[model samples]
Target: MYRYDQYDHLIVRERIAQYRDQVARRLNDELTEEEFLPLRLQNGLYMQRHAYMLRIAVPYGLLSSAQMRMFAHIARKYDRGYGHFTTRQNIQFNWIELEQTPDILADLASVEMHAIQTSGNCIRNITTDEFAGVAADEIMDPRPFAEILRQWSTFHPEFIALPRKFKVAINGAVEDRAAIAIHDIGLTLTHNEAGEAGFKFMAGGGMGRTPIIGSVIRDFLPWQHLLTYTEAVMRVYNSYGRRDNKYKARIKILLKALGVEEFARLVEEEWQDLKDGPETLTREEYDRVAAYFAAPAYAALDNIDPLAAHADSKPFANWLQRNVKPHKVPGYAAVVLSLKKTGVPPGDATAEQIDFVADLADKFSFGELRVTHEQNLVLADVKQADLFEVWTLAKSKGLATPNIGLLTDIISCPGGDFCSLANAKSIPIAAAIAERFDNLDFQHDIGDIELNISGCINACGHHHVGSIGVLGVDKDGSEWYQVSIGGAQGNDSAIGKIIGPSFSGGQMPEVIDRLLQVYVRNRVEGERFVETAQRLGIAPFKEHVYATPISKGELVGEDHA
Candidate 1:
């Protein structure tokens, strides 16, 4: 993890002081809501339906055990006894008091953390693959570049008030776990023909109301010019992106209107002037940042036989199968703590759970933990020998759901329960679906299905890329849900297609059941839900979900890719 320098600490402390005064003014009525809105948003504070929500940035999803303890303290003392981990690798504290947010931020600053750039029209948190340095297939660690971008973008005057919030994601692994295709600016780190490290740049991708995958603007860019080229791209967007309508303000909309070729041409023209400026990355800077993310020390040990160790326990075997992932180290595995337990909203961790996990991280993972973009926590370096003990502890704390990529490992936002922008509640929908597919055997048979729910088209839950997407809609002042299918994340990411008309919230579980039934019936041997859906178009599933009163023969006839 990157530690803050004296300068870093000084800047955060100053920002906290400034925000403290600003918040005091708002509470004292010296500043109206309109005047305080931007001020508060820049500090990552939002006025939700019931109370304020404070978003805290967990840079590149890395958290030290100390930082995790601070989060636990905040949840226990300031907000309610819980915090919500979000899909962007950040955490949210609902039920915040405006007067207390500065104090919360001060505490975060004490731990080398803050809420900077988590909200507002400025460039939001720069995210990367959660498995960045540890993944076996990684070409290079992407966190150094991610941290470089974070330092460059923080309060940059040119980009402070862009047309809309901008997001950047980098993927360094052979598999694109960062969902690079869906970010405003996506970078895939790779080596060129000459064996020099560089990037493949994709721009204008986003998923709000208009979901579009980004197009490649540069097939290859040298590592040295990374920041300069990024600056050029942002300059073009900041200058020409739409300002008329909030709905059409994202860079994706700009790319659509300008065409990818023209957008690339403009970025190229802008880069010609700024390619070798002072902003060009230097060897020393790269080395300095890369050193911070170096791998931790590990004891030399042979790989343990998990099967032999847990021979008598099916529960341990099940957890090992679902929750544990392969680690690059010989005697270690990465364990995902599923926050999507049935009946609980996805990603909600109580203060007690947080503290327990912090202790677990200290005892098992070198006092470090990671937050995944899928709304889960990861103890990324747990020893294989201690797997049973870790599992037992997690189970005691209600963290051992053993459904990392399964249907019940849902990704969802705090919908109508917290956000005023939500049209309906998403937590209940997630719970309903989790309950519908509660059987572990049944869920495993379903096989690696991502069910994402969003309360509205803002797509915070990333519904556009789920294998089964449930989106809440407002229809005639009542809650309705529109289902989409065949979507996927990773290198082969694709936006899902809407099945048909929206269904009532009460019908969601049944609709999901019918869709899964369609999948199970039509699937060939060893086929996953997504593969089956892709093989047989959305017609069969649509027919089953909507109950169109069509014959099986008619559905078969319509199932053409």
Candidate 2:
């Protein structure tokens, strides 16, 4: 993890002071809600259903153990003892008083963390693959470049406000876990034929009212030209991106309106002007940034029997098998701390659990924690020797759920409970599905299933990326749930299909169960749920969910099978 340098410290402190004054002015009625809205959002604070929600940025989804403990401290002391990790790899604290947000910001600053750029229509958080440095398939660590982008975009005068929100994700791994195609700007770092590092640029991708995968506008953008090329991309977008209507304001709509070739030509024209500017990253600066993200030294360990460890019904072994993945280092495994426990809301980690995870990270793994873009926490460099110990400590805190990549490991948003835009509750639906799939072995057997839940169609829950997506819709005055199937995340990103008409909240679990059961029965041997779905399409699962009879008092669509 990069420790904040003097320049970093000074700028962040100044920003915090500025936001504090802005918040104070708003509370004193000096600024109207309309005027304060953007300012507050820029600081990662939102006026929500019950109270203000404060989103804390975890840069590149990386946090030190000390930072994690500070988060737990703030959650316990100021707000409720709970925080919600988000799909964008940030954490949100609900129930915060608007006036107290500045204090929270100050506390976050103490740990070299702040929520700036987490929201509003500027370049938001620069995200990357969850397993950036240590993934076996990674060509290089993407965080250094992510950090470069973060610094370049933070309060950059020209792009303070755009026509609409913009996002950027980078991945160096052959497997794209960052959902690069679904970002406003996506960069995949790879080596060129001459063995020089570079980025492949994709533009006009986003998810919201409209969902479209990004197009590769520029390939082989040299390493030194990252900032300049991106500056060109942003300048083109800022100049020509739509601003007429909020719905039509996204860069995706603009790119769609202009053909990809024309868009690429425009960006090229813009880049030609800004190609050799001061913004271009020099070899020295690149090395300086990369130095901060070099992997920590790990002690060598002997590999033991991989199967014999599971004989004693080691509760942690089940979790390790499902959630942990092989590390580039031979004796280590990347540990995923799943927040999707049955009956508990997805991505909700209490203060105690947060503290426990932080402690576990220090004791068994590196003294760092990573909040993944998929709304889960990761201990990225745990040695294989320490897996059992880490699992026990995690199990003690109810964080040992083994349902990773399964139907139960749902991704949910702070739906009606917090988001004013949401039509219904999301937590309960996620809980219901998780409980239904509580049978651990069954969930593992299902394998690599993604179940996403959103309170509404805003798609904050990443419904567009789930194998089974649950979207909340309002009919008249009641809440109804819609299901989408066949979506996937990772290197192959695809939007889900709406299975049928919406169902009442009560029918959600059974419908999900039926969907999974259909998959279980129809899938050929050794086929993953996603592959099975692709082979057969949503027809089979959709048929079963629609055909199944529901209990009395449950709402069903008129066109039921």
Candidate 3:
């Protein structure tokens, strides 16, 4: 919700003009594809398998209804009828015309949005919990710090071209909804024994071919040194991170090669010179940014039990149980508009649906919504009294599936369908799984689960951290799906282990069903799928999934057959 000032306005307008010129040159054959590649990437344009894909940044996942409407307009006018929301909380249009991207960006700039730093080996969008300011468990709102980082890092000359892409996530809540452990740099807002707010800094966490959790670099970095310390970390990585191979270029690879102690030592040595310098955040600067995120005006009212009145309404009760979240404020609730309807691609919204969500945000929330890292949208400040009405409207638009955190609430990437880098189609795999578990009663019985699907090892869908992960692989020039179990995100984040050999796309649903059976059988009372998997380990699940040889007919569709 940070409004652009004169300087912000000037910077965006100038960038757009520069990109417009660059795009024109590319079209005119004045600039070769090699020359225009970096320029276009810097602007978040990609040449996909079919058409160009444009990724627009939604900083810290915050969006005003006005911005949402702009997205809807862009989807309707420039791209196809729908856009894909990504795991990073950004949105992508798959059928973009390279020539029209500048116009699209100009349209975005009108709403104080841009596509800068969305791709390339630079610091991508800084992300955090969708319920940042409204979470009951938050120690402090993390958005101000996130915004401060955003302002500082945008086009920073030193980090514009790192050895590989960098990502940072900050979490202010007791729960790690932001998945801090799997970021290049992760910060947890905390207070020192002296009651001074600071961060628990962790670095080197990432997922790809080599998945590893970040190590804590500093137990308590005082709030003032946030920027200085962050710069120091970047400086260390930039100085020594590998440039030879893209696979080993991430900071996590560097941290692994050097060890945590040495990495921390280097960062500290670098920080000594920068600490307490002008880059150190002062109270006044903090306040300036914090003002934008001050609490919204609320009506004086007591909290009410929403379920009391909807007890007889099964549909309403189901939606309330899955989609509604507790708010920090009384008389309010945060609602997730589920994008994981059975047949729809995960995290995709049609132009009309996007507009409808914008309308809902205006009517129910404070004209705002937050995009969850889980590929859902959150109306973070809905009145509890208006829950039913919100649900009714959302369900009518196929945005109220009541499957948040459940098996069908899958997080998936636009795989072979849109991304040239993908090995197999991810959307269909997600669709098959969702259809398999469409029964609400069966899903609730399975309990909270994070099921993620990625087309490749890039981990864009964050399959490495899902309770059940499905990864698409290229096997003998054929697309096969690999299943992993026991992974989880949050305070106790862990990378999943591959159960066994890859399966045909058609075998994915049956494979998942077998994994769940193992979970249900081994789980004790009150155990979730992840808890049960962790307790019994992957052996039992692996055995059951591959135990029975599937008939040849099962491999007939969407596979090498």
Candidate 4:
């Protein structure tokens, strides 16, 4: 939780004034829709199918309880009664009024938050693991570096109008919870043989028209040169990335055209003049940023099995197993507040739910919480002794579904319902799958699955890396769903392969059921669905899904794969 300085406050206030004038001009007919497009996009405002959508940045997914309460207020006053959390750990309001946007921005600014860089063809929000500072497996805390990048990249003149939107993610843990492999620029905090901290830098990774896992550009970049090296990569991209077609403009496309070796060479050549320059991070600067993320005070206590007393309570035991994660500190845990309730849209929270979560964070988690890229919220420092109390309160609010990493814990985008770019509605399909596997016993039996749904190929829902991916496509003016298998996130991330012909939306539940059956039949003991699919390849699952013949009317489109 980085506090805003006087300069930070001044910057936000000035931006709010500028945007207010811009909105007024648009409303007064002084600026036409064409003229207002980029201006509004710079502030994270979008003209959707039905109304405007506003995306607010939650940097590195960190939020204070006070800020969460502000979000609740905005949800209640500005746009409908709820807001949708996104895969990037940002939040969106679907129904926004054109004239009220400035007021909303002002409200956000009051809380040291803004919509800046949430959209536009510039560097977007920098993201990382939700459990960054507290993960037991972390080699180092990455938030300081993430914050440094945030400060450096915001409104950088060189990158204000890049070829396409750029995303960066960093992971400090052994597990790749941040999905570093699928970002434009990915960094993993590591140590050299001498045990000095540095980063394993990768570039040219992205998902969209073309999905690519980033290639490691530098095995060990010294920590001090983080900014200089990053600027070098951006300089290479900004210089040669395509400008002719928006579809081919991402750095990944450019990297593919020119081989990785050439890209690395170019970056190194650019780094020669910039390395060890004034932009090199000093130890004092690192300490100043790191101070903001220092651990909260804790009483002397020993680790205890909080679940021992709840052995007879199946609900409590199940929740403990699924929603609670181990903490780096003794007698503490990180608790996930599930947003994947069966009837609700994935990652959405109502105003009351938002307020309730804020209260819970204050009471249980040092007045702070982190938003997971999986569309859940984490109370990163809850006492293990208070697990049952936290669970009880969250369950009453429909925020404790006990489905983390399970089939029911789906990651989905606001599809045709809110986004004009979507091909089909994503919410209903996600609901169908969640309802089908509503039984906790069944989901647990399936074991640690990442099911992602996207309305289109943009991969906002990250379907490309799901254990099972559902993508919405338009076929002959009708909405159809495509299923893919063997996709996974983390260190060994891979894009999923389409199983066969696309099926109608109505057939999705059964299609998923069939895929799971193949996994169950072929899997050896202790293997997860993705591992089993990898071991057997896509042939068995494809055969199982298409085994039962159907009428020609049921098929929507032939598999492009």
What's the count of clashing pairs in each model shown? 0, 0, 0, 0
Q: Who is ahead in TM-score, 1 or 3? A: 3
Q: How many backbone clashes are present in model 1?
A: 0
Across 1-561, the per-residue lDDT of candidate 4 in tens digits comes to: 799888778888998999999999988999999999999999999999889999999999999999998889999999888989998999999889999999999999888999999999898999999999999888899999999999999999999999999999999999999999999999999999999999999998988778888899899999999999999999999999999999999999988888999999999999999998999999999999999999999767789999798888998999999999888899999999999998888999999999999999999999999899999999999999999999999999999998999999999999888889999888888877788789999998999999999999898999988999989999999999888888888999988888888888778888888899998888899999999988898899988888886433332322211
Clashing pairs in 3: none
Q: Compose the digit string of candidate 2's lDDT tens values, residues 1-561.
A: 888889878887888888889988988999999999988898998888888888888888999999999889889988888888999899999879887878888898888998888888899999998899989889889999999999989888899889988889999999998999989899999988999999999998877678788899988899889998888888888998878898988889989999899999998999888888888889899899889988788888765544466667756567768878878988888989889877677898999999988988888767988998778899989888777777778888888888778778788897887898899888877766676668877777788788888888778998877888888899999988888888887678888878888888888878877887888898999888777778888788778877858652443222100
Overall lDDT per candidate, in order of appearance: 0.89, 0.84, 0.92, 0.91
Model 2 accuracy (lDDT, Cα) = 0.84
Scored against the true structure, residue 491 in model 3 reaches a CA lDDT of 94
Q: Can you rank all candidates by TM-score, best first?
A: 3, 4, 1, 2
- What lDDT tens digits, residue by residue, belong to model 1 across residues 1-561? 899988788889999999999989989999999999999998999999889999999988999999999999999999879999999999999989988999999999889999988998889998888778877688989999999999989989999999999999999989999999999999999998899999999998889799998899999999899999999989999989989999999999989899999998999999999988899999999999999988899889788887796699988899999999887778988899999888778999999999999999999999999999999999989889999999999999999998889989999988877889999888877877788789999988888999999999999999999999989899999888889998888888889999999877667777888999998898998988988888798888877776653222110111100
Q: How does model 3 score by TM-score?
A: 0.98
Where does candidate 2 stray beyond 4 Å?
306-310, 552-561
Q: 427-464 in candidate 3: lDDT tens per residue?
A: 88888888878999999999999999999999899999
Clashes by residue pair, model 4: none
Between candidates 1 and 2, name the one with more favorable lDDT: 1
